[model samples]
Target: MPERKPPRAAPLVLDVNSGYDELNLGRLALISGQKTVPPGLRRWQKTILTPDGRPVVITCTVPDDQVVPHGLDNDFMVGLVNLCFEAGLPDGPFTVSAYGLLKASGFPDSAQYYRALEESIVRLNKANYTIDEGWFMHGPHSWTTQSFAQVNYLSYVRSRSGVRGTSVITVQLAPPIMESLRAGYIKPLDLNFYRSLSQPLVRAVYRQLDALHFDESTADGLVRELSAPLMAWGSRLGILSDRPDNVARTLKPAHDELRARGYVAEVELTGRGRDKLLRYVFGPPPVGEYPELALLLSARGVKSGVAVRLSTVFPERIEEAARRFDHYLKISSRPVANPGGLLVAMVQRPEDFAELPGYAAADARPGPPPAETPAKGTGKGRSARQRPAAQDELDALEAREEAKLAALQGQALVDWVLKQLTLLGTMKHFTLPERSQLAELVLHGQLDGRTVVREATRAIAGGAPAVLAVVEDVRRHLQVTHP
Candidate 1:
């Protein structure tokens, strides 16, 4: 008999904290359908001085300077992000079908559309980034980091192909891109509604709103439903200007439609003179303000005063408790006899969240696919949506880092990083996080791949009693022995 594998290390269980709504799992790009294809080699660069005066610079380049990608690419990237999370960050070439891409993106399957897919791939591959003095986590140890850390996406295009061919493309994600998806700093989006919205600006506005964080308390100690501060143009959409006159023209249309749809409790575009901005608030879901909380109660058939006490006595613990509940569900293979009672206990005992089966000890048992997912963007390759209102802060942060990278001359540094990662992945069993630590070492051209790998292998096998200790040993060895 074939040796039974331990059930393929059941895929990691995801709760609200690690899955679904907690993250806006997509790449950043303009949702607006820009008809103009950038003609030649296109490049963008920006630089910023942090409050502490550390300079961060970014630079990016794309093929055919005039035909920069817009919503089409954004739609394609969002589909990839979704795949990474759903597949538990599998070592890629994530497979996608051509028909699926067309359906998700609303592109008609035709020769013209096929060409569109071909161009998007070229635009993506030509895209590159460099950042000097980067801020985002480049690695667990530290290095010269590449701005476009995500691997360039790969796909196949053939002449006169539509919905008839194999309809499959394999996507391989870079270390940085995969890590960002795994990070919880994301928000939820309803892609179904996104596909239905025909207007590009509407999709743009939707991504903006969906990205706002849910803070129960204001900076002034005032409690409120939700609030977000957004810029009118510029980086938010990667187009137009934030100038006084340019702020309202295109945005007004999106603004009106958004409020009319009841997605925003309040979305107002108001700013004095050249400082145009938007303040958006969220409305409750259909069942009420806190649908997840409410449903859990209704399931347990709790008493009427329970909600009031929980809010009054332990208002602070509610959100964290809910997160814990989710984490609990992720680890526990069995159902709880009393979920409501368990939630209440969590509220009273918030510290217990850490004790739940988590990163170091999470059950990787495979489970069914997420229930009721929206169709994948246009077969294996395209997407179209008015977009959702959720904005990913991580995306925003990467944008900042990428912008700075684009402004700097750092190709040698970018190449060194690519080499280290390529070698490590090929030769070592280091986890993603572990690889990140090793990545930082590449910053100043410290150690060659062979040396680093030898150190890691030696430290891991050399009597370290635990994983954390082994990691620490590697870190120590790099600092003292290597450099």
Candidate 2:
């Protein structure tokens, strides 16, 4: 028998999606270095400039019942997102045990830790944010305004023995972040390296630093050197003190830890007194965001841009496809004329390569094809008094959609939902939360996909507001019936 290589574990890195990373990078203070939040610090607002110096207002509110997320909440948030990727990035709700979350976050899975986890989750769930202008939409590659809770919803069900036994938790990630994640606006963070630091403050600082260093527009798509004024740095890291000396004192231990770990080559405080600026020269970045997959693709002569783009956009599928392609290349009866092109094709359409063992997971799971565009001038001359469609036409449309629903797999709900919105002429008017709610309904089987499309089509005559009303009614019905 030929010697075979052992299976490799997926990389232990958190793929921090864009806009959320900016929340911790100083636009909003989601993480705090303080062990306990000050009383009455429920709402805070700040105005910051975008990369192009456009002013944006960010407002963050913590519910009266729940405290602002602070301390170890950062670890929990990071761990939860990492778990999402590990589970293949399900687009809807998923269950994970509370103990599993604790372990993944580098905390001991004990009663106290479990309690801490529960409270942190609550805080995260109730935290509401409104970004008047700085939310980055990766699909459009533009900045826009947005409002959402940090988490959509969370349910905790404990076993009979409560803290002594396992407890399963269901979490729904917020919509805008999910959209950005799917759009591939992600940065890599070595979770193992993050958890290795001794101090919570150090870990928090390092998380922010890692995000700060990943600049997609830069030459290598990384900022090797970073500089910030002391006061602003404190705000970014959630350091409680505003005094220059106080901030410096609090940051010293974290700075020392980062330097000792060799992640930071040097940390310098330039200038004098309150005007002091802190600069960081970081050690080399990890190979590529998806190192193992990148290596396999590069070895097969794949171009760097193509490899990175595919890997970023399809992190879950690309790795599996690449591994299968590797095995196929080794066992094929004949040589591939263009190995790079072949691998690229496989990654893009894994279902076509299902005969390969590595692509088994992707079998029968083709992504939805792009929606067809209506020809120009087809609906261009319609007046405000015009009816969207005859009642009989809508009935036929509903019947056709109902027929399609029986064959629809859960993965296509988002696209199907978008199609309905597009038909109603309300796609641009719908908020992210509204779109997410409609998708979640179809995904969880709370509402039939056909009903969504039917209602949307029927509401078209009344314009976007009417379509919005139908969505709200569906959501309310689900809440009352299911909750």
Candidate 3:
């Protein structure tokens, strides 16, 4: 018998800090990249990436005609990360079971699900990734630079009747990667929660969110707030963009998906122009029945970091604001100017909160008092002479609120313009330059948001390229016709 070779010794080991290796970008995992395959025969051909704040070059290649394993495939790869730790993060041909893969993946035990697992394994074997940096040097098994895909090898029965359950697979880890795993080159993650998500982008987003700690650290050591420049954040997540609004449009659904399912507590977007800030407020990981107002709370806020601070100090007050505020947005016919600040105010003074969403009549704001017809030509005879002093006070209060109501409408209109433009921008219609000008108009009050939005909607019919011309035309038209 031939002498058996010992598992290769890793000269370089991975640890938390090394995760910040120039190539890895200080993230526990590279959460963003092209996760899914495009529909046709075109290869996933993004040849290079130079990230901001210190460019780190990453070279990518996927064999032509091979589907660049969908985002969902990553769930299994993450499972392998956890498995590596459990198996002592060794370097070699380690074996894992078909049953275990399916179970950890949260996929059904049905035959179809088994096939899906088989498919992901195949895809992983096919895709390749390379990181360029000195600290990220090559290992013995690699030719010169080791492909991330080079470290993996999987084999399993693919036919439906080939195996009933608990089939085994041999996984080989790169020597350097094994060393990194042993050195704790990983972040704590909610594996089960990650597997539960249906969308790949949402899953990837969750990893980014879960991996990041925020300003308000809880008593239990959980992170609840995150503040980062939108562009930096998108870059960290590997979003292919220099624009925050463009990035936001792609990540918005992930935020919504997380909020809808209650994994995220709240989220807010605020700041000036293209260099905007994004704040994500997290909640206790969903363990029981979720509150119905979670989405409303997540959606409502400005300077949300402050609002989250209030929630951290007084947790119950957040729900109170959400329950009442949701009612207000739905029925008040006006959007609150600064929902984040209002929530903090409500927490301090609880009495200001409105009724729940469905109770419109009970919660509606009072309007101005009814007018009297000059007392049948006797102008001097005050019709309100018989009315109570309380009515006069109420009328005054209603007038002040009426002005705020117009402010609310204006804010709502602006929000609509931003939302529409960002969405169209994602479709390639709204350019960064066009977005910059529109944002300036918004900041300067140079254009009516409602008008710009209507023009934008009309222009979108042709294609994204037409958006700029339309917006410019709208601006000129507004200056000449409406100014």
Candidate whose TM-score is highest: 2
Q: What Cα-based lDDT does every candidate model obtain?
A: 0.46, 0.64, 0.51
Q: For this target, which candidate reaches the highest lDDT against the unseen true structure?
A: 2
For candidate 1, lDDT tens digit of each residue in 1-483?
A: 001112111111111121122222232332323334345526655453322334556566655453555556655555555544544455545433343344334556576765666555556555766666543332473323446623366654343543222233445665565554444334445666665566665776566445433221223111223322234234445444546555556566776787787776776666576565656666653232344554454344333234333343333355656666777777889988877668766665454445665633233354663444346654322212312222456578678865654442222232223232232233233433334334334433444533443444444444534434544555675657445
Q: Give each model a TM-score.
A: 0.50, 0.59, 0.44
Worst 10 residues of 1 by lDDT: 1-10
**What are the runs in model 2 whose C-alpha is more than 4 Å off?**
1-29, 47-56, 158-165, 288-483
Expressed as tens digits, the lDDT of each residue in 1-483 for candidate 2 is 001112112222233332123233323445675566687778766565454457677777886876667788888877776665544445565444455567667787578888788888888898888888678774455887888876787866553545321344557778876665544455555666777789778888887777656654554445778887888778655666768999999899999989999989999998877899999999866454666676667677676545554564456676677777878887888989988879877775565676764434533554664444555668443432233465568889878766665565553443344444443444445344444445556666776766666777788788868888986777686567557
Give lDDT for model 1.
0.46
Q: Global CA lDDT of candidate 3, please? A: 0.51
Q: What's the distance in Å from true for residue 479, model 1?
A: 55
Count of backbone collisions in candidate 2: 0
Query: Ranking by TM-score, best first?
Result: 2, 1, 3
Residue 442's lDDT in candidate 1: 43
After superposition on all CA atoms, what RMSD does each candidate show versus the true structure? 19.5, 16.7, 26.1
| Model 2 lDDT, full chain set | 0.64
